[model samples]
Target: MSSVDATPIGAGAKARGAGGRRPIGLLLVAAPVALVLGLIIWPVALSVFDTLTVHGPQGLEFSLEAYRFFFTDGFSLRNLWLTIRVAAICTVLLLVISLPIALYLRFSETRLAGYIQALALFPLFVPSILLAYALIRTLGPNGTVDTLLVAAGLPKMPTPYLTPWGPIIGLVWDNLPLTLLIVLAGLANVSRASIEAARDVGAGSLTILWHIILPRIRGTLLVAASFVILGLFSAFTLPYLLGPAAPEMMGPFMRRTIIEVDDPVQARTQAVVTFALCAVFALFYVRSVARSRREQTS
Candidate 1:
Protein backbone atom coordinates (compact mmCIF):
# COMPACT_ATOMS: atom_id res chain seq x y z
CA MET A 1 0.00 0.00 0.00
CA SER A 2 1.17 3.55 -0.67
CA SER A 3 2.27 5.33 2.46
CA VAL A 4 0.01 8.17 3.70
CA ASP A 5 1.35 11.67 3.21
CA ALA A 6 3.38 12.85 6.23
CA THR A 7 2.16 16.45 6.13
CA PRO A 8 -0.71 17.16 8.51
CA ILE A 9 -3.96 18.13 6.74
CA GLY A 10 -4.68 20.90 9.24
CA ALA A 11 -1.24 22.52 8.80
CA GLY A 12 -1.57 22.46 5.01
CA ALA A 13 -5.05 23.95 5.20
CA LYS A 14 -3.88 26.66 7.64
CA ALA A 15 -1.02 27.69 5.39
CA ARG A 16 -3.35 27.85 2.38
CA GLY A 17 -5.89 29.86 4.39
CA ALA A 18 -3.28 32.41 5.41
CA GLY A 19 -2.02 32.70 1.86
CA GLY A 20 -5.55 33.25 0.63
CA ARG A 21 -6.18 35.99 3.20
CA ARG A 22 -3.12 37.96 2.13
CA PRO A 23 -4.75 39.11 -1.11
CA ILE A 24 -7.94 40.06 0.69
CA GLY A 25 -5.96 42.08 3.26
CA LEU A 26 -4.08 43.87 0.51
CA LEU A 27 -7.31 44.54 -1.36
CA LEU A 28 -8.90 46.05 1.72
CA VAL A 29 -6.07 48.52 2.24
CA ALA A 30 -5.40 49.27 -1.43
CA ALA A 31 -7.95 52.08 -1.68
CA PRO A 32 -6.67 53.97 1.36
CA VAL A 33 -3.05 53.51 0.28
CA ALA A 34 -3.88 54.77 -3.16
CA LEU A 35 -5.72 57.77 -1.74
CA VAL A 36 -2.76 58.69 0.43
CA LEU A 37 -0.38 58.43 -2.51
CA GLY A 38 -2.66 60.41 -4.81
CA LEU A 39 -3.78 63.13 -2.40
CA ILE A 40 -0.86 63.73 -0.04
CA ILE A 41 2.25 62.36 -1.69
CA TRP A 42 1.48 63.75 -5.13
CA PRO A 43 0.73 67.27 -3.98
CA VAL A 44 3.74 67.39 -1.68
CA ALA A 45 5.99 66.14 -4.48
CA LEU A 46 4.61 68.80 -6.84
CA SER A 47 5.07 71.52 -4.22
CA VAL A 48 8.68 70.50 -3.63
CA PHE A 49 9.31 70.42 -7.36
CA ASP A 50 7.79 73.86 -7.81
CA THR A 51 9.86 75.21 -4.94
CA LEU A 52 13.11 73.84 -6.46
CA THR A 53 12.55 74.69 -10.14
CA VAL A 54 12.03 78.14 -11.67
CA HIS A 55 11.51 79.59 -15.13
CA GLY A 56 14.91 80.97 -15.99
CA PRO A 57 16.27 82.56 -19.18
CA GLN A 58 17.46 79.06 -20.20
CA GLY A 59 14.06 77.46 -19.42
CA LEU A 60 12.83 75.59 -16.31
CA GLU A 61 16.19 75.32 -14.55
CA PHE A 62 16.82 74.41 -10.95
CA SER A 63 17.30 77.44 -8.71
CA LEU A 64 17.54 78.26 -5.02
CA GLU A 65 16.65 81.94 -5.33
CA ALA A 66 13.48 81.56 -3.25
CA TYR A 67 15.39 79.68 -0.54
CA ARG A 68 18.20 82.22 -0.62
CA PHE A 69 15.72 85.05 -0.33
CA PHE A 70 14.01 83.34 2.60
CA PHE A 71 17.32 82.97 4.42
CA THR A 72 18.59 86.44 3.56
CA ASP A 73 15.38 88.42 4.09
CA GLY A 74 15.23 89.96 7.54
CA PHE A 75 11.47 89.54 7.97
CA SER A 76 11.49 85.91 6.80
CA LEU A 77 14.47 85.07 9.02
CA ARG A 78 12.81 86.66 12.05
CA ASN A 79 9.57 84.71 11.48
CA LEU A 80 11.47 81.46 11.08
CA TRP A 81 13.48 82.16 14.24
CA LEU A 82 10.35 83.08 16.18
CA THR A 83 8.53 79.94 15.05
CA ILE A 84 11.46 77.79 16.19
CA ARG A 85 11.70 79.57 19.51
CA VAL A 86 7.99 79.31 20.23
CA ALA A 87 7.92 75.63 19.27
CA ALA A 88 10.83 74.90 21.59
CA ILE A 89 9.25 76.74 24.51
CA CYS A 90 5.86 75.04 24.00
CA THR A 91 7.46 71.61 23.77
CA VAL A 92 9.31 72.16 27.04
CA LEU A 93 6.23 73.48 28.78
CA LEU A 94 4.10 70.56 27.57
CA LEU A 95 6.67 68.12 28.93
CA VAL A 96 6.85 69.86 32.29
CA ILE A 97 3.09 70.13 32.69
CA SER A 98 2.14 66.75 31.23
CA LEU A 99 4.78 64.55 32.87
CA PRO A 100 3.70 65.23 36.42
CA ILE A 101 0.07 64.71 35.57
CA ALA A 102 0.89 61.52 33.69
CA LEU A 103 2.90 60.28 36.60
CA TYR A 104 0.05 61.04 38.99
CA LEU A 105 -2.48 59.31 36.78
CA ARG A 106 -0.26 56.28 36.42
CA PHE A 107 0.49 55.87 40.13
CA SER A 108 -2.57 57.22 41.85
CA GLU A 109 -5.74 55.25 42.72
CA THR A 110 -7.78 57.99 44.30
CA ARG A 111 -11.18 59.11 42.94
CA LEU A 112 -9.69 62.49 42.15
CA ALA A 113 -7.46 60.95 39.50
CA GLY A 114 -10.49 60.52 37.23
CA TYR A 115 -11.46 64.14 37.66
CA ILE A 116 -7.93 65.32 36.94
CA GLN A 117 -7.76 63.15 33.83
CA ALA A 118 -11.10 64.50 32.61
CA LEU A 119 -9.88 68.03 33.21
CA ALA A 120 -6.66 67.36 31.31
CA LEU A 121 -8.58 65.98 28.35
CA PHE A 122 -11.22 68.75 28.31
CA PRO A 123 -9.29 70.69 25.65
CA LEU A 124 -9.72 67.84 23.18
CA PHE A 125 -13.44 68.49 23.02
CA VAL A 126 -13.05 72.25 22.63
CA PRO A 127 -12.62 73.71 19.16
CA SER A 128 -9.52 75.80 18.43
CA ILE A 129 -11.54 78.83 17.36
CA LEU A 130 -13.67 78.64 20.49
CA LEU A 131 -10.55 78.17 22.57
CA ALA A 132 -8.99 81.22 20.93
CA TYR A 133 -12.02 83.37 21.65
CA ALA A 134 -12.21 82.06 25.21
CA LEU A 135 -8.58 82.92 25.72
CA ILE A 136 -9.19 86.42 24.40
CA ARG A 137 -12.12 87.02 26.72
CA THR A 138 -10.28 85.62 29.72
CA LEU A 139 -6.82 87.12 29.13
CA GLY A 140 -7.22 90.02 26.75
CA PRO A 141 -6.70 93.62 27.90
CA ASN A 142 -9.27 94.66 30.55
CA GLY A 143 -10.78 91.20 30.26
CA THR A 144 -11.59 88.78 33.07
CA VAL A 145 -8.04 88.51 34.42
CA ASP A 146 -7.44 92.24 34.50
CA THR A 147 -10.84 92.84 36.04
CA LEU A 148 -10.03 90.31 38.78
CA LEU A 149 -6.66 91.89 39.42
CA VAL A 150 -8.21 95.31 39.67
CA ALA A 151 -10.87 94.07 42.07
CA ALA A 152 -8.26 92.36 44.28
CA GLY A 153 -6.26 95.53 44.88
CA LEU A 154 -3.32 94.32 42.87
CA PRO A 155 -1.58 95.59 39.76
CA LYS A 156 -2.73 94.08 36.48
CA MET A 157 0.08 91.92 35.15
CA PRO A 158 0.88 92.09 31.44
CA THR A 159 -1.48 89.90 29.45
CA PRO A 160 -0.02 87.29 27.10
CA TYR A 161 -2.73 88.10 24.53
CA LEU A 162 -1.49 89.52 21.21
CA THR A 163 2.15 88.68 21.92
CA PRO A 164 4.57 85.78 21.49
CA TRP A 165 3.41 84.52 24.86
CA GLY A 166 -0.11 84.41 23.47
CA PRO A 167 0.67 81.66 21.00
CA ILE A 168 2.79 79.88 23.58
CA ILE A 169 -0.08 79.79 26.05
CA GLY A 170 -2.64 78.79 23.46
CA LEU A 171 -0.40 76.10 22.00
CA VAL A 172 0.38 74.66 25.40
CA TRP A 173 -3.31 74.52 26.26
CA ASP A 174 -4.35 73.14 22.89
CA ASN A 175 -1.65 70.45 22.93
CA LEU A 176 -1.92 69.42 26.58
CA PRO A 177 -4.45 66.63 26.05
CA LEU A 178 -2.41 64.85 23.42
CA THR A 179 0.84 65.26 25.33
CA LEU A 180 -0.70 63.94 28.52
CA LEU A 181 -2.17 60.92 26.72
CA ILE A 182 1.20 60.03 25.17
CA VAL A 183 3.01 60.37 28.53
CA LEU A 184 0.38 58.27 30.26
CA ALA A 185 0.71 55.53 27.66
CA GLY A 186 4.46 55.60 28.17
CA LEU A 187 4.06 55.39 31.91
CA ALA A 188 1.83 52.32 31.52
CA ASN A 189 4.87 50.34 30.31
CA VAL A 190 6.78 50.86 33.57
CA SER A 191 6.80 47.70 35.71
CA ARG A 192 4.90 48.14 38.93
CA ALA A 193 7.08 45.46 40.49
CA SER A 194 10.17 47.41 39.64
CA ILE A 195 8.73 50.55 41.23
CA GLU A 196 7.70 48.63 44.31
CA ALA A 197 11.12 46.98 44.56
CA ALA A 198 12.80 50.36 44.40
CA ARG A 199 10.46 51.63 47.09
CA ASP A 200 11.23 48.63 49.28
CA VAL A 201 14.90 49.64 49.13
CA GLY A 202 14.01 53.06 50.57
CA ALA A 203 14.05 54.96 47.27
CA GLY A 204 12.25 58.30 47.57
CA SER A 205 9.71 59.43 45.02
CA LEU A 206 12.08 61.80 43.27
CA THR A 207 14.88 59.27 43.34
CA ILE A 208 12.67 56.54 41.95
CA LEU A 209 11.34 58.96 39.36
CA TRP A 210 14.80 60.08 38.29
CA HIS A 211 16.44 56.66 38.30
CA ILE A 212 13.55 54.49 37.21
CA ILE A 213 10.57 56.24 35.64
CA LEU A 214 12.30 58.86 33.49
CA PRO A 215 14.77 56.38 31.98
CA ARG A 216 11.99 54.00 31.01
CA ILE A 217 9.90 56.68 29.34
CA ARG A 218 12.71 58.65 27.66
CA GLY A 219 11.77 57.35 24.17
CA THR A 220 8.11 58.21 24.73
CA LEU A 221 9.08 61.73 25.79
CA LEU A 222 11.08 62.17 22.57
CA VAL A 223 8.11 60.96 20.52
CA ALA A 224 5.77 63.39 22.27
CA ALA A 225 8.24 66.25 21.76
CA SER A 226 8.54 65.38 18.09
CA PHE A 227 4.78 65.45 17.60
CA VAL A 228 4.33 68.69 19.56
CA ILE A 229 7.13 70.44 17.70
CA LEU A 230 5.79 69.27 14.35
CA GLY A 231 2.29 70.49 15.13
CA LEU A 232 3.53 73.81 16.48
CA PHE A 233 5.75 74.35 13.43
CA SER A 234 2.75 74.06 11.11
CA ALA A 235 0.25 75.67 13.49
CA PHE A 236 -1.85 78.48 11.98
CA THR A 237 -5.01 79.33 13.85
CA LEU A 238 -3.54 79.88 17.29
CA PRO A 239 -0.48 81.73 16.05
CA TYR A 240 -2.52 83.75 13.58
CA LEU A 241 -5.13 84.99 16.03
CA LEU A 242 -2.91 85.38 19.09
CA GLY A 243 0.55 86.16 17.76
CA PRO A 244 2.10 89.55 17.05
CA ALA A 245 1.59 91.44 13.75
CA ALA A 246 5.34 91.59 13.10
CA PRO A 247 7.52 88.46 13.27
CA GLU A 248 4.53 86.08 13.36
CA MET A 249 4.77 82.29 13.37
CA MET A 250 5.28 80.39 10.11
CA GLY A 251 1.58 79.68 9.61
CA PRO A 252 0.49 83.30 9.49
CA PHE A 253 3.69 84.29 7.77
CA MET A 254 3.03 81.80 5.00
CA ARG A 255 -0.57 82.95 4.67
CA ARG A 256 0.44 86.59 4.49
CA THR A 257 3.12 85.72 1.95
CA ILE A 258 0.51 84.08 -0.23
CA ILE A 259 -2.29 86.62 0.22
CA GLU A 260 -0.63 89.93 1.09
CA VAL A 261 2.78 89.72 -0.58
CA ASP A 262 1.38 87.42 -3.33
CA ASP A 263 4.62 85.44 -3.42
CA PRO A 264 3.73 81.80 -3.98
CA VAL A 265 7.37 80.83 -4.56
CA GLN A 266 8.46 82.29 -1.25
CA ALA A 267 5.58 80.63 0.54
CA ARG A 268 6.41 77.29 -1.04
CA THR A 269 10.06 77.71 -0.07
CA GLN A 270 9.07 78.42 3.51
CA ALA A 271 6.85 75.33 3.49
CA VAL A 272 9.72 73.22 2.18
CA VAL A 273 12.03 74.53 4.88
CA THR A 274 9.41 73.90 7.52
CA PHE A 275 8.87 70.39 6.16
CA ALA A 276 12.62 69.70 6.35
CA LEU A 277 12.72 70.74 10.00
CA CYS A 278 9.61 68.69 10.84
CA ALA A 279 11.07 65.72 8.97
CA VAL A 280 14.04 65.63 11.30
CA PHE A 281 11.76 65.28 14.31
CA ALA A 282 9.50 62.87 12.45
CA LEU A 283 12.49 60.66 11.72
CA PHE A 284 13.46 60.76 15.38
CA TYR A 285 9.94 59.72 16.36
CA VAL A 286 9.90 56.86 13.88
CA ARG A 287 13.30 55.62 15.06
CA SER A 288 12.21 55.79 18.67
CA VAL A 289 9.10 53.76 17.85
CA ALA A 290 11.11 51.20 15.89
CA ARG A 291 13.70 50.88 18.63
CA SER A 292 11.00 50.45 21.24
CA ARG A 293 9.34 47.73 19.15
CA ARG A 294 12.66 45.95 18.65
CA GLU A 295 13.34 46.04 22.39
CA GLN A 296 9.89 44.63 23.11
CA THR A 297 10.27 41.83 20.57
CA SER A 298 13.82 40.95 21.55
Candidate 2:
Protein backbone atom coordinates (compact mmCIF):
# COMPACT_ATOMS: atom_id res chain seq x y z
CA MET A 1 0.00 0.00 0.00
CA SER A 2 1.47 3.33 -1.01
CA SER A 3 1.43 5.87 1.82
CA VAL A 4 -0.23 9.23 0.97
CA ASP A 5 2.12 12.20 0.98
CA ALA A 6 1.40 14.42 4.02
CA THR A 7 3.29 17.54 2.87
CA PRO A 8 1.60 20.91 3.44
CA ILE A 9 0.67 23.21 0.55
CA GLY A 10 3.70 25.13 -0.77
CA ALA A 11 4.25 28.69 -2.02
CA GLY A 12 3.07 27.68 -5.49
CA ALA A 13 -0.35 26.75 -4.11
CA LYS A 14 -0.55 30.02 -2.17
CA ALA A 15 0.35 31.91 -5.33
CA ARG A 16 -2.43 30.13 -7.21
CA GLY A 17 -4.89 31.02 -4.49
CA ALA A 18 -3.95 34.71 -4.69
CA GLY A 19 -4.20 34.61 -8.48
CA GLY A 20 -7.70 33.17 -8.20
CA ARG A 21 -8.77 36.05 -5.95
CA ARG A 22 -7.34 38.76 -8.24
CA PRO A 23 -10.41 38.77 -10.48
CA ILE A 24 -12.72 39.14 -7.49
CA GLY A 25 -10.73 42.14 -6.22
CA LEU A 26 -10.85 43.71 -9.66
CA LEU A 27 -14.59 43.13 -9.87
CA LEU A 28 -15.08 44.83 -6.52
CA VAL A 29 -13.21 47.94 -7.69
CA ALA A 30 -14.62 47.96 -11.25
CA ALA A 31 -17.67 50.12 -10.61
CA PRO A 32 -15.88 53.04 -8.96
CA VAL A 33 -13.07 52.85 -11.49
CA ALA A 34 -15.60 52.97 -14.32
CA LEU A 35 -17.35 55.94 -12.72
CA VAL A 36 -14.07 57.85 -12.37
CA LEU A 37 -13.22 57.18 -16.00
CA GLY A 38 -16.65 58.29 -17.15
CA LEU A 39 -17.13 61.33 -14.93
CA ILE A 40 -13.62 62.70 -14.51
CA ILE A 41 -11.31 61.29 -17.16
CA TRP A 42 -13.76 61.78 -20.05
CA PRO A 43 -14.56 65.39 -19.18
CA VAL A 44 -10.87 66.19 -18.71
CA ALA A 45 -9.97 64.65 -22.03
CA LEU A 46 -12.68 66.67 -23.77
CA SER A 47 -11.47 69.86 -22.09
CA VAL A 48 -7.92 69.19 -23.21
CA PHE A 49 -9.09 68.48 -26.74
CA ASP A 50 -11.16 71.67 -26.76
CA THR A 51 -8.26 73.79 -25.51
CA LEU A 52 -6.02 72.47 -28.30
CA THR A 53 -8.50 73.06 -31.11
CA VAL A 54 -10.68 75.87 -32.47
CA HIS A 55 -13.68 76.25 -34.79
CA GLY A 56 -12.35 77.66 -38.05
CA PRO A 57 -13.43 77.91 -41.67
CA GLN A 58 -12.11 74.38 -42.04
CA GLY A 59 -14.17 73.31 -39.01
CA LEU A 60 -12.41 72.27 -35.75
CA GLU A 61 -8.82 73.00 -36.67
CA PHE A 62 -6.02 72.20 -34.22
CA SER A 63 -4.54 75.31 -32.62
CA LEU A 64 -2.56 76.49 -29.57
CA GLU A 65 -4.16 79.96 -29.48
CA ALA A 66 -5.69 79.40 -26.03
CA TYR A 67 -2.36 78.34 -24.51
CA ARG A 68 -0.54 81.10 -26.34
CA PHE A 69 -2.89 83.70 -24.86
CA PHE A 70 -2.40 82.27 -21.36
CA PHE A 71 1.38 82.35 -21.61
CA THR A 72 1.70 85.74 -23.29
CA ASP A 73 -1.11 87.72 -21.69
CA GLY A 74 0.03 89.87 -18.73
CA PHE A 75 -3.24 89.60 -16.80
CA SER A 76 -3.30 85.83 -17.14
CA LEU A 77 0.31 85.56 -16.03
CA ARG A 78 -0.44 87.75 -12.97
CA ASN A 79 -3.41 85.62 -12.01
CA LEU A 80 -1.36 82.45 -12.33
CA TRP A 81 1.42 83.94 -10.24
CA LEU A 82 -1.06 85.11 -7.60
CA THR A 83 -2.57 81.65 -7.40
CA ILE A 84 0.86 80.04 -6.96
CA ARG A 85 1.88 82.55 -4.32
CA VAL A 86 -1.29 82.18 -2.28
CA ALA A 87 -1.24 78.39 -2.43
CA ALA A 88 2.42 78.27 -1.39
CA ILE A 89 1.82 80.61 1.53
CA CYS A 90 -1.22 78.71 2.70
CA THR A 91 0.57 75.36 2.47
CA VAL A 92 3.42 76.63 4.60
CA LEU A 93 1.03 78.10 7.17
CA LEU A 94 -1.00 74.88 7.37
CA LEU A 95 2.09 72.78 8.07
CA VAL A 96 3.36 75.22 10.68
CA ILE A 97 0.03 75.50 12.50
CA SER A 98 -1.05 71.86 12.29
CA LEU A 99 2.17 70.15 13.31
CA PRO A 100 2.23 71.59 16.82
CA ILE A 101 -1.41 70.75 17.46
CA ALA A 102 -0.86 67.24 16.15
CA LEU A 103 2.22 66.82 18.35
CA TYR A 104 0.34 67.95 21.46
CA LEU A 105 -2.56 65.66 20.78
CA ARG A 106 -0.31 62.73 19.99
CA PHE A 107 1.62 62.90 23.28
CA SER A 108 -0.77 64.49 25.74
CA GLU A 109 -2.94 62.50 28.10
CA THR A 110 -5.11 65.51 29.01
CA ARG A 111 -8.86 65.54 28.66
CA LEU A 112 -8.77 68.86 26.78
CA ALA A 113 -7.13 67.15 23.80
CA GLY A 114 -10.52 65.98 22.60
CA TYR A 115 -12.02 69.45 22.90
CA ILE A 116 -9.07 71.03 21.17
CA GLN A 117 -9.35 68.53 18.33
CA ALA A 118 -13.06 69.24 18.08
CA LEU A 119 -12.42 72.96 17.85
CA ALA A 120 -9.69 72.49 15.27
CA LEU A 121 -11.99 70.35 13.16
CA PHE A 122 -15.00 72.63 13.59
CA PRO A 123 -14.44 74.26 10.21
CA LEU A 124 -15.05 70.90 8.54
CA PHE A 125 -18.73 71.04 9.50
CA VAL A 126 -19.19 74.69 8.51
CA PRO A 127 -20.04 75.33 4.87
CA SER A 128 -17.41 77.25 2.93
CA ILE A 129 -19.97 79.81 1.74
CA LEU A 130 -21.15 80.41 5.29
CA LEU A 131 -17.54 80.62 6.51
CA ALA A 132 -16.81 83.18 3.81
CA TYR A 133 -19.82 85.26 4.83
CA ALA A 134 -18.88 84.99 8.51
CA LEU A 135 -15.33 86.04 7.68
CA ILE A 136 -16.69 89.01 5.77
CA ARG A 137 -18.87 90.03 8.70
CA THR A 138 -16.14 89.60 11.31
CA LEU A 139 -13.14 90.92 9.35
CA GLY A 140 -14.69 93.20 6.77
CA PRO A 141 -14.71 96.98 7.15
CA ASN A 142 -16.59 98.11 10.29
CA GLY A 143 -17.21 94.45 11.19
CA THR A 144 -16.74 92.90 14.64
CA VAL A 145 -12.96 93.30 14.89
CA ASP A 146 -13.03 96.81 13.50
CA THR A 147 -15.88 97.76 15.80
CA LEU A 148 -13.97 96.50 18.84
CA LEU A 149 -10.79 98.32 17.74
CA VAL A 150 -12.71 101.60 17.31
CA ALA A 151 -14.46 101.10 20.63
CA ALA A 152 -11.07 100.79 22.34
CA GLY A 153 -9.81 103.99 20.61
CA LEU A 154 -7.19 102.04 18.70
CA PRO A 155 -6.43 102.90 15.08
CA LYS A 156 -8.18 100.70 12.53
CA MET A 157 -5.92 97.87 11.47
CA PRO A 158 -5.46 96.59 7.94
CA THR A 159 -7.78 93.65 7.38
CA PRO A 160 -7.02 90.71 5.07
CA TYR A 161 -10.62 90.63 3.79
CA LEU A 162 -10.06 91.97 0.25
CA THR A 163 -6.33 91.45 0.02
CA PRO A 164 -4.29 88.42 -1.11
CA TRP A 165 -4.00 87.60 2.59
CA GLY A 166 -7.76 87.02 2.74
CA PRO A 167 -7.66 83.74 0.86
CA ILE A 168 -4.49 82.75 2.67
CA ILE A 169 -6.18 83.09 6.06
CA GLY A 170 -9.36 81.36 4.97
CA LEU A 171 -7.51 78.52 3.25
CA VAL A 172 -5.30 77.97 6.27
CA TRP A 173 -8.32 77.79 8.59
CA ASP A 174 -10.29 75.51 6.28
CA ASN A 175 -7.39 73.11 5.73
CA LEU A 176 -6.10 72.90 9.31
CA PRO A 177 -8.22 69.91 10.31
CA LEU A 178 -7.07 67.78 7.40
CA THR A 179 -3.44 68.73 7.88
CA LEU A 180 -3.58 67.96 11.61
CA LEU A 181 -5.26 64.63 10.98
CA ILE A 182 -2.60 63.57 8.52
CA VAL A 183 0.19 64.56 10.87
CA LEU A 184 -1.48 62.71 13.74
CA ALA A 185 -1.84 59.61 11.60
CA GLY A 186 1.86 59.80 10.86
CA LEU A 187 2.62 60.34 14.54
CA ALA A 188 0.90 57.08 15.32
CA ASN A 189 3.81 55.29 13.70
CA VAL A 190 6.17 56.82 16.26
CA SER A 191 6.46 54.29 19.05
CA ARG A 192 6.29 55.42 22.66
CA ALA A 193 9.20 53.11 23.43
CA SER A 194 11.46 54.98 21.03
CA ILE A 195 10.45 58.31 22.55
CA GLU A 196 10.98 57.02 26.04
CA ALA A 197 14.37 55.60 25.11
CA ALA A 198 15.38 58.92 23.62
CA ARG A 199 14.25 60.68 26.78
CA ASP A 200 16.26 58.24 28.88
CA VAL A 201 19.31 59.09 26.76
CA GLY A 202 18.93 62.74 27.78
CA ALA A 203 17.17 63.77 24.59
CA GLY A 204 15.04 66.83 25.16
CA SER A 205 11.58 67.22 23.59
CA LEU A 206 12.94 69.40 20.79
CA THR A 207 15.82 67.01 20.16
CA ILE A 208 13.52 63.99 20.09
CA LEU A 209 11.14 65.79 17.76
CA TRP A 210 13.86 66.85 15.35
CA HIS A 211 15.69 63.55 15.38
CA ILE A 212 12.84 61.06 15.61
CA ILE A 213 9.32 62.43 15.20
CA LEU A 214 9.89 64.77 12.26
CA PRO A 215 11.90 62.21 10.31
CA ARG A 216 9.20 59.57 10.71
CA ILE A 217 6.43 61.99 9.73
CA ARG A 218 8.25 63.56 6.79
CA GLY A 219 6.13 61.64 4.28
CA THR A 220 2.94 62.65 6.04
CA LEU A 221 4.06 66.29 5.89
CA LEU A 222 4.67 65.95 2.15
CA VAL A 223 1.22 64.42 1.65
CA ALA A 224 -0.37 67.25 3.63
CA ALA A 225 1.52 69.87 1.62
CA SER A 226 0.49 68.30 -1.68
CA PHE A 227 -3.15 68.11 -0.61
CA VAL A 228 -3.19 71.71 0.65
CA ILE A 229 -1.54 73.02 -2.52
CA LEU A 230 -3.95 71.11 -4.75
CA GLY A 231 -7.03 72.22 -2.82
CA LEU A 232 -5.91 75.86 -2.72
CA PHE A 233 -5.15 75.85 -6.44
CA SER A 234 -8.69 74.77 -7.24
CA ALA A 235 -10.40 76.73 -4.45
CA PHE A 236 -13.25 79.00 -5.54
CA THR A 237 -15.64 80.01 -2.82
CA LEU A 238 -13.32 81.55 -0.23
CA PRO A 239 -11.08 83.08 -2.84
CA TYR A 240 -14.05 84.48 -4.69
CA LEU A 241 -15.57 86.02 -1.60
CA LEU A 242 -12.40 87.11 0.22
CA GLY A 243 -9.76 87.77 -2.42
CA PRO A 244 -9.13 90.92 -4.41
CA ALA A 245 -11.03 91.52 -7.65
CA ALA A 246 -7.89 91.97 -9.79
CA PRO A 247 -5.11 89.41 -10.20
CA GLU A 248 -7.50 86.73 -8.97
CA MET A 249 -6.52 83.17 -8.15
CA MET A 250 -6.89 80.59 -10.93
CA GLY A 251 -10.27 79.44 -9.59
CA PRO A 252 -11.91 82.86 -9.91
CA PHE A 253 -9.85 83.68 -13.00
CA MET A 254 -11.18 80.61 -14.78
CA ARG A 255 -14.77 81.45 -13.86
CA ARG A 256 -14.38 85.07 -14.99
CA THR A 257 -12.87 83.94 -18.29
CA ILE A 258 -15.82 81.68 -18.92
CA ILE A 259 -18.63 83.96 -17.75
CA GLU A 260 -17.45 87.55 -18.21
CA VAL A 261 -14.93 87.08 -21.00
CA ASP A 262 -17.03 84.30 -22.60
CA ASP A 263 -13.97 82.27 -23.54
CA PRO A 264 -14.50 78.62 -22.70
CA VAL A 265 -11.42 77.58 -24.65
CA GLN A 266 -9.23 79.97 -22.69
CA ALA A 267 -10.84 78.84 -19.44
CA ARG A 268 -10.13 75.22 -20.34
CA THR A 269 -6.55 76.16 -21.08
CA GLN A 270 -6.26 77.72 -17.63
CA ALA A 271 -7.75 74.59 -16.05
CA VAL A 272 -5.38 72.27 -17.90
CA VAL A 273 -2.46 74.42 -16.85
CA THR A 274 -3.65 74.31 -13.23
CA PHE A 275 -4.06 70.55 -13.44
CA ALA A 276 -0.53 70.22 -14.78
CA LEU A 277 0.82 72.20 -11.82
CA CYS A 278 -1.15 70.13 -9.33
CA ALA A 279 -0.04 66.93 -11.06
CA VAL A 280 3.60 67.70 -10.33
CA PHE A 281 2.85 67.83 -6.59
CA ALA A 282 0.59 64.82 -6.94
CA LEU A 283 3.48 62.85 -8.43
CA PHE A 284 5.70 63.89 -5.54
CA TYR A 285 3.07 62.71 -3.07
CA VAL A 286 2.73 59.38 -4.87
CA ARG A 287 6.47 58.87 -4.79
CA SER A 288 6.62 59.70 -1.09
CA VAL A 289 3.83 57.24 -0.31
CA ALA A 290 5.45 54.51 -2.39
CA ARG A 291 8.79 55.02 -0.68
CA SER A 292 7.11 54.89 2.71
CA ARG A 293 5.38 51.61 1.91
CA ARG A 294 8.63 50.10 0.63
CA GLU A 295 10.42 51.13 3.81
CA GLN A 296 7.70 49.61 5.96
CA THR A 297 7.67 46.34 4.05
CA SER A 298 11.42 46.02 3.91
Candidate maximizing TM-score: 1
**Candidate 2 residue-wise lDDT, 37-73, digit = tens:** 9999999999999999989998999999889989999
Pairs that collide in candidate 1 are none
Tens-digit lDDT track of model 1 for 213-245: 999989989989998999999999999998899
User: What TM-score does structure 1 among the candidates reach?
Assistant: 0.92
- State candidate 2's TM-score: 0.90
Off by over 4 Å in 1: 1-21
Tell me which residue pairs clash in candidate 2: none
Local distance difference test scores for all models: 0.87, 0.86
lDDT of 2 at 210: 98
